[model samples]
Target chain A: MRPRLFTPGPTQIPERVRVAMSNPMMHHRGSEFKEILAGVIDDLHYFFQTEGDVFVLTSSGTGAMEACVVNLLSRDEKVLTVSGGKFGERWGELCVAYGANTHIHNVPWGDAVNPDDIKKFLRENSDTRAVFITHSETSTGVASDVETIAGIVHNNSDALLVVDSITSAGVLPFKMDEWGIDVAVTGSQKGLMAPPGLSVVAMSQRAWERVGSSNMPKFYFDFKKEKVALAKTATAWTPGITLLMGLRESLSMIRAEGLENMWANYARLAHATRQGALALGLELFAHSPSDSLTAIKVPESIDGIKFVNRMREKYGITVAGGQAQLKGRIFRIAHMGYYDALDMVAMASAVELTLRDFNWNFEPGAGVRAVQRIFMEDE
Target chain B: MRPRLFTPGPTQIPERVRVAMSNPMMHHRGSEFKEILAGVIDDLHYFFQTEGDVFVLTSSGTGAMEACVVNLLSRDEKVLTVSGGKFGERWGELCVAYGANTHIHNVPWGDAVNPDDIKKFLRENSDTRAVFITHSETSTGVASDVETIAGIVHNNSDALLVVDSITSAGVLPFKMDEWGIDVAVTGSQKGLMAPPGLSVVAMSQRAWERVGSSNMPKFYFDFKKEKVALAKTATAWTPGITLLMGLRESLSMIRAEGLENMWANYARLAHATRQGALALGLELFAHSPSDSLTAIKVPESIDGIKFVNRMREKYGITVAGGQAQLKGRIFRIAHMGYYDALDMVAMASAVELTLRDFNWNFEPGAGVRAVQRIFMEDE
Candidate 1:
């Protein structure tokens, strides 16, 4: 049996999105392909709720994150980064690679960064050129308060507020304009409900000016060149046309469902998942959680890797193990993309079965029942 | 009617390959996905005819190109580049983007770079770290003499030889080991018969050593991180699982046909296309034309854009127009990926009809007869 994907990324792609990718290849530079691409950009802008310039790059979300750095900051420029999980540390590492002066506001592994800490750092370091943070830290399943942080950044200095929204853009509330997010990046595989390989980056006019003044060297991820080419409905190089086609289909689905409705659906699923985990006697890892996914702390007796493997081998269900330092301690259950109530219940049932196999004390059928109760209550 | 794609990149995808991508999404970090990824790497090694490390990146071929420069060269490192066409110039541009001191071995457009010039330059500048050239320059349809240049680079200095086989990998004769290519990059959409969004890069041990010492910044395209994760058939970031499924099918077709047979087929198609174009009184652009694509220079009386537009409007055929400065002067017809003798004849017939619409002096059945004669002779 084919495994159902409940991983944080490479999420469950709908049959329609998969079918859309099967369309015969088209010339990326041709007018027909451009028409499809322009449609995607328009839909993405609507989803992002920003009139700012949005561009799609043929890469994972990390590529777009790197673009945020290479385009907005020059060598030796000061950047303030918030480190709370695996993805949060990525900002500091990227800055180090680019020879930038990085100041990290680090938190515990499963905790979200406080906006007050960001304000303090900005006050202490007036030379900070940018503040990089993860809107939703997938590794910890925690969502940072981007709106509060963005407001603080604007009030303090002219530093651009950059957010990695890879796992949250579609599943949660991410209003680029309303949140005052200068630059936001996302990938196709997560909340966008498509496969990987395509990334979207939306930038405000203020962010565009910063990109122009930044002296960092880049070519493939050059936002300015990409923007100019995109204005003509083309790209500087051959794009991943098949992935773009998939993205167009996925975005159409998102628009049809309506962004607000989609976010609400995710929130409902996440609440059900949390309730189900509690019913199984498992604990949530995050103090503040994101609706996209949930990080569950494995019981002391239960091996996380073994549990993940058992789910895959026996039940043909695929979920994500804890990343980096959290390995074998926690596991993540994704509730984004093409996921629904049935998916949540199925995952909850699997967790219940796997916990019993591991000899962890959990009531049989309790988790699924709890999820059903939550769904009914919400209805 | 389904439109025929004859563009240089994003070439025609086979029905079987398209069907392969329709498989349901798989979790990238799962064992099942790893099995598929390992199979692709093994097949790629076989196709490349090298035991060197091969990496699959989720981007266009240009991203692989950037990976090559960023992973191999440090700031202010001197490199030699050959610019004969649009893609060749890309090497120089990327090198500049990475702050590499670049020396250009300039060749006029539509002509192959002279190996002797490269050898002389390397001898004069011993600090030149690498030599970059394109095996097949898609814009001009010129296939450079990489074998000779590789031999010259090895004989002259310790410089690495990097070749862009984006448009030539499967169709052209390229033995990475025998040809002394340290780094070679190709895309999936061309001769691989897969859709766009997947790029393959093969590296020698010497190149890997350079990557270790190079300090240029990278994350999503990080070769070292990818190499470690790919050992277990996983990517550092979310991969394009759907595209990988498509590539698996395409590779199966390649193996069944045999690489030698595939190369011979491309050569035959190239010969028939050139003969057909010549019969229609069209000039071939490249002095050393690639087997993958045939570039036909339009007559002064006929607008190349109009000729291309009419072919698409009338016959639903999409061809590639000239690049940058060469726009409206030439058009390219690709015979790569899922194309056969019948497809070639159809394209030739469409070109014949479109040219006739422009009042060109040509016999009614000239192009088709020439192509048929070539096929009959081959039989």
Candidate 2:
């Protein structure tokens, strides 16, 4: 059997998107590609829910994060970074790497960052140039309250509110213009329902002013050059043509489903998965779980590494093992993109089967029953 | 009819490679992907003809160029750049953007840079840190003698030899280790027979020593982090997973054809294309033409812009128009990846028909006859 993907970022691609990409290659500078790009740009405005500028870059999500840092602030500038998981810590690392004077607000793993702490950091360090936040930390399956943090930063300091919404943008209720976010970035994977190549970034008017004066030396990630090319319905460099073709279909799928309905579907899937895990007497790993994925703590009697390996080797289900400090302690089941309630039930059933082999105390059909109940009640 | 891609890049992807990418998505951290990455890394050494470190980065070829500059030299360091066309000019621009003390050696648009002039530049400025050269200037279809320049830099100064082999690596005879190149970079779209997302870089032992002490602040393009991850058959960041799958098949196709045969095929195609254009009494653009593409100067009586438009509208063909200074004066027909001699015949036939539409003095079938003769002779 073909292995199923239940990971957070590199989710399953829909059939139409795959077929669209499988068609013949087209030149980037051709009129056909320009029309496709213009349509993508229009669709991106709906994706980001912003009246500001939105750009597509041909890199992974981490490159988008670096573009945000290099474009918004100069060297030696003060910034506040919130760290609660692996992805959150990357913001601080990026700041340090680019010679920014970063003040990291550390939060406990499996817990979300507090908005009050961000306000306190801005108050203490009155000259912060930017504030970095991870809307959905994929490593811990925790979602921070970005809207509250954006409010706190906006009311307190002149710092630009930059967000890494790689796993949150299309899966959750994110309104870039409504939240007054300066910069928000996401990848083609995860909530975008495409493959992992292109990354999209939306900038507010406030962010564009800072980008013009930022002294960071950049070329590939230069926002101004990209903006100039975007005016002509082109990209600064030759983009990933096949991936963008896939994205055009994925974005169309999202639009047809309606962004609001897609977010609601993800919420339902997350709810069912969480209930199924709880029904098996498994403990959750995150204090505030993201709708994107759910992290479950491994039982003490079970070998976490072996449990994960068996899920892949025997069941042909590819779920994500915990990263960094939480390695072998937890496993994440994603409900992010191109997944539905039936998929959640299959995942819950796989967990039940895997647990029986580990000699864990769990009823055979209990987890799957709980997932079905959640969907049945909603219907 | 489906539109044929005769543009330099993004080139025509092989059907097998596209089928490979259309398979179901797999997790990047899974064992299956790790095996794929390991195989790709092994095959890349054969692709670049290097025993030194080879890395695949998820960005455009321009990003690979920027990676070489940022990882090898610090700010305010002296460097020499040779510019003969648009792609060549980019090397100098990258150096200046990163605050390097850049000295650009400008050659005429259609001519290759003189190797002796590079010797003079290094001798006059003995403190040069790196010498940058474009192996194939794509805009003008000019090919520089990289082997001769590599020797000049190695024998003359302590400068590192960095080459932008984006259009030349798999199409031409570029032996990274054999030529003593310090750094060489190429993109997937041209010679690799893959889509346009991933770029590969090969670095010598001498370049690694400089990378250790280079103080340019970088995160996404960090070669150290990539090198460490590569040792484990992984990437520092989440890569373009689908593109990498496509690359595996493309590299396999390259290996099956044998690298030497692929180079000879490109040379034959370039020769046939040049002879075909010359048979119609057309002038060639470059003094030293690259084997990857052929640029033909448009006759003054024909409207260049309309000639290009009619080639696309009347017939389903997409060839690249000249860029920058050569724009509207010349047109380029690429004989790069996934193209055979029949594709060359079709391209030449299209050019003949387009010229006839503009009432130019050219006999029908002369160009096609020359192309057919070349292929028949080879058989």
Instruction: Give the number of the best model, judged by TM-score.
Output: 2
Pairs of colliding residues, candidate 2: none
Residue lDDT tens for model 2, B91-113: 99999999899999999999999
Query: Which residue runs does candidate 1 get wrong by more than 4 Å?
Result: none
Q: What share of the true interface contacts does candidate 2 keep?
A: 0.87
TM-score, chain B, each candidate: 0.99, 0.99
Model 2 residue B157 lDDT? 97
Q: Could you give candidate 1's per-residue lDDT for residues B18-37 as a string of tens digits? A: 99898888877666778889
How many backbone clashes does every candidate have?
0, 0
- Per-residue alpha-carbon lDDT of candidate 2 for residues A3-45, written as tens digits (9 for 90 to 100): 8889997998898988888888999988899988988889989
TM-score of 1: 0.98
Q: What are the candidates' interface root-mean-square deviations?
A: 1.1, 0.7
Query: Candidate 1 clashing pairs?
Result: none
Give model 2's docking category: high
